[model samples]
Target chain A: MAVASDTIAAPEHSAEGRSETIAFLIMTAVLIVAPFFIYPLFLMQALCFALFACAFNLLIGYVGLLSFGHALYFGWASYLAAHAAKVWGFPPELAILTGAATGAVLGLVAGSLAIRRQGIYFAMITLALAQMMFFFALQAKFTGGEDGIQGVPRGKLFGLIDLASNNTMYALVVVIFLACFLLILRIINSPFGEVLKAIRENEPRAISLGYKTDRYKLVAFVLSATLAGVAGGTKAIVFQIASLTDVHWTMSGEVVLMTLVGGLGTVFGPVAGAFVIIAMQNYLNALESWVTVIQGVIFVVCVLLFRRGIVGEIAHLLRIKL
Target chain B: MFEIFGIPSNALFSQLLIGLINGSFYALLSLGLAVIFGMLNIINFTHGAQYMMGAFMAFFLLQYAGLSYWWALIVAPVVVGLFGMIIERTMLQWLYKLDHLYGLLLTFGLALIIEGVFRNYFGSSGLPYAMPDSLRGGQNLGFMFLPNYRAWVVVASLVVCLGTWFVIERTRLGAYLRAATENPTLVRAFGINVPRMITLTYGFGVGLAALAGVMAAPIYNVSPQMGSDLIIVVFAVVVIGGMGSIMGAIVTGFGLGVIEGLTKVFFPEASNTVIFVIMAIVLLIRPAGLFGRTA
Candidate 1:
């Protein structure tokens, strides 16, 4: 089993190196030219969700921990960042950082509590914890309950560039997303990541090997939460609002769908998955109530037969790492 | 004239009664979850939706078919159980070879589809399921007013939960079920149909959830959103109870429900979230859950 994993790891390592180059090139081209073709705001929304899905993938794919409650971190951070920028008059970068920090702290606490069990129990724990957050947001005055914290100012980026313009905001988001994405990629290839994979395959074996598995799992959880926070924070700025929908259990499930649909273990799978799902959502949103039914169908289909997901299947057919 | 914690005994007792009622539903639902988990190794995310389906079934029976609540009680669970059986046979049976997480994901998807369709057909707003004429009105306890229907709910759920417990824990049939849960292949070797047992177990679990829905209809508004919200709290309850023991799920369910009621009295703002807070604490102190065996 170890040898099989290592063989898989070898291809993945070379694949990661190749994909990073491709990603960087694609991002550069998009930054330079895509704005002319696509709407900046739409692109910004996609980037935010893309980052969120990638962060989510970090835990589920790499660590083999499927968190059904990630929206707590993402939604809470969005609320904090929205409130900070809108109510406290903070700069965009600071607000975003504050959101990420909040998510890391929350992840630390939630991870400590959730990592007590394995597999299905772990998923349930995270889900229940996130639901608790949803209730908190529903009642907390700062969250404004159903009204939410709306009309948030985009504020200035790094105290210099004005984000009120779509083009500048898009550029800013693209940079933040690329940095976070690369950071995830780097972590996946690190020794720390290998231990996570080992733990994923067999925790008892990993523990017997004298590795402090808990510490590694905790760090991975925190990192995933923090990056998800970054995505949520960016989303708040782009939408100029943060609502209960951001924190709902449904949102958490949506992210899971994105990751699963993209490819669970693949590095770039979540990004591809997020784009496809977000675009599908966008298209379905025009159809009103049918969106949820369609999303549900997609989820069932994916789980029942399409386990490799869009990117995973593509990677397999193309004979290349995603 | 009795007093506890500086509050009137009437108010306290009344709240306790409400807590017990809520706990009954929780106990029933979590019991179903544990039973399903035992045999199928799948957490039925659609349990809540199916529960909602029970209430809807009762409502539709009354509204369209002119059947009474008593009749619906007998029929709703059977209908919902049949739906569950079909689901297990068709879609869920395919997932047994994959990771357990896939089962969770698949059930969650089914839940979404069920809830979404219900919401689309019925609208997001709640529909009222009127109390049957036979079960309407209050009992008027000397200290506190005990609504007759509420008392009926509490008693009915307790009976159902206990009956389920008996079937799963005490009966010879239950021994076969337990043996299958422990080692299905061995049970199969003994000439017991393990696969059929799994399908029936899932059906029975779904039926339990539907029964809870029937009990809950008059107490809470019969809404499309009803089960989706309640299921998450039940998930926490399951975690707290550890899904290890039948009686544990029952005890934890009722205990958490009472605690939540107390929170309502002490801090109304936290009422909705108290169960989750307790789950967090439970996870910290007893990660395997109160009744769950250490993994």
Candidate 2:
């Protein structure tokens, strides 16, 4: 599968790769200038979600594995970071790192257990595992249960730059988002990423060709989980809170929806999707149930008729990868 | 009261009975999921929402039509089944050629829309569903008293479950369904209406979930969010059972529910998560599941 894709993708691969890079540059530039015109808090929230969706996209896009319970990593990290910052009085960067490390451990344990199943069972297993974490968070006293870890301090970045300034915090969030985004891109384009794709296209074939497919999959899962944790930790710091809402199944569903709405495998599609969905919530807060209905309708529409999504469709029409 | 291991025998019996009742619902719901997944290949994420709709159907029938519980048991499944058929015809059927995950996503959307709309109108608080006169009394068996309605739920669900098993595993109609799903083109070549059968199969599967919902109304409050939470657990049941056989689904559903009940008695804190914990263990030990075939 890898060799076959190489032959087919070789010709268009450069063009697609070039276009993707261009799109990334354009997006980064827009985002850099974005905080100047918009509410920094709202933009920070959107960027956080976008980063989460991108981490989620790495698995489903490159590995063809749909993890239905990703809130475990995201929410768990958010809580951990909240606790670390508020209780330990740790710096923001250190708290975020602590959260991401915990996320990696969680991914290693969960990803190993979940990889035992394939296809539909795989999705269900991840979801069930995440639900277990949700229950833990609910019952565990350190998590603060339903009330969550409120009044979490953002704290100083690197114990140097005070993150109290909206613009300064925005700069940190944007940097984090860009770094994670680029890391995902580099991972997928690397030789390891090719093997991951081959495994996705046909695992037996990849295994037959002497590749340890399971290890690759496990690595991909851990990377996705840790990256999702980073996004969640950043979000908690921005909002200065960590709550049950982040750990809910609906939150997991939201990440999946964003990835789908953007384009599963497309590089920048999740960012677009994250913005679109957050915007919907921000603008249509009054609609209540209708917002949920609309999200559902979008889910249905994306799956049935528009699987390529907004950015994906544009890229497809232009014969370029996003 | 007699004691067993420092616990009262009556308390144990009551929990056992509660387990049996919960098991019945799980069996019915998981059976429906297995049946639909057999033909449609979709996990039917909206199964929970449809189950809620079934309870709502009974609620409305009682409120406006003044129908009895007996009538609801007979009527709700049919109405909800037809609605499912419409969904299959209009939406689900289109995704057969695409990846099955798309169907899951699409049905998830449908579930959200259904649950959200209902929640919008009714609010999250549950509505009361009174026990019918015919099934309200309890039977005293010296050690423990048994609620007639609860017993009836267990019996009815068992009958429906095994009846489905018999039809699918032993009958000619079941053979045709097996043949149709395994190879529709080949089955169609033999002069059968494969498409119609597929549609009806989906309807029948959906009907089973509604039936369970109807059974649950008097036991639990009639609420919109009721099926949503239950459905997630049932999905764990389906995974643990492996969707390879009808009886496997039934067995896993009941067994897990009973285990969950036992957890409630023994370690109340873990009751809510025991099924999922067992699911993870099963995945590690027997990834194909207890009764499931290796995929």
* Chain A TM-scores in order: 0.94, 0.97
TM-score between candidate 1 and the true structure: 0.97
Q: Which residue window of length 10 is worst by lDDT in model 1 chain B?
A: B134-143
- Complex DockQ, candidate 1: 0.83
Off by over 4 Å in 1: A1-12, A27-32
What's the lDDT for all of these models? 0.90, 0.91
TM-scores for the candidates: 0.97, 0.98
Clashing pairs in 1: none
Mind listing the fnat for each candidate?
A: 0.76, 0.78
Could you give the interface RMSD of each candidate, to one decimal? 0.8, 0.9
Clash pairs detected, candidate 2? none
Q: Give candidate 2's error at residue A181 in angstroms.
A: 0.4
Model 2, B246-282: lDDT tens digits are: 9999888888878888788888899889999999888
DockQ of each: 0.83, 0.82
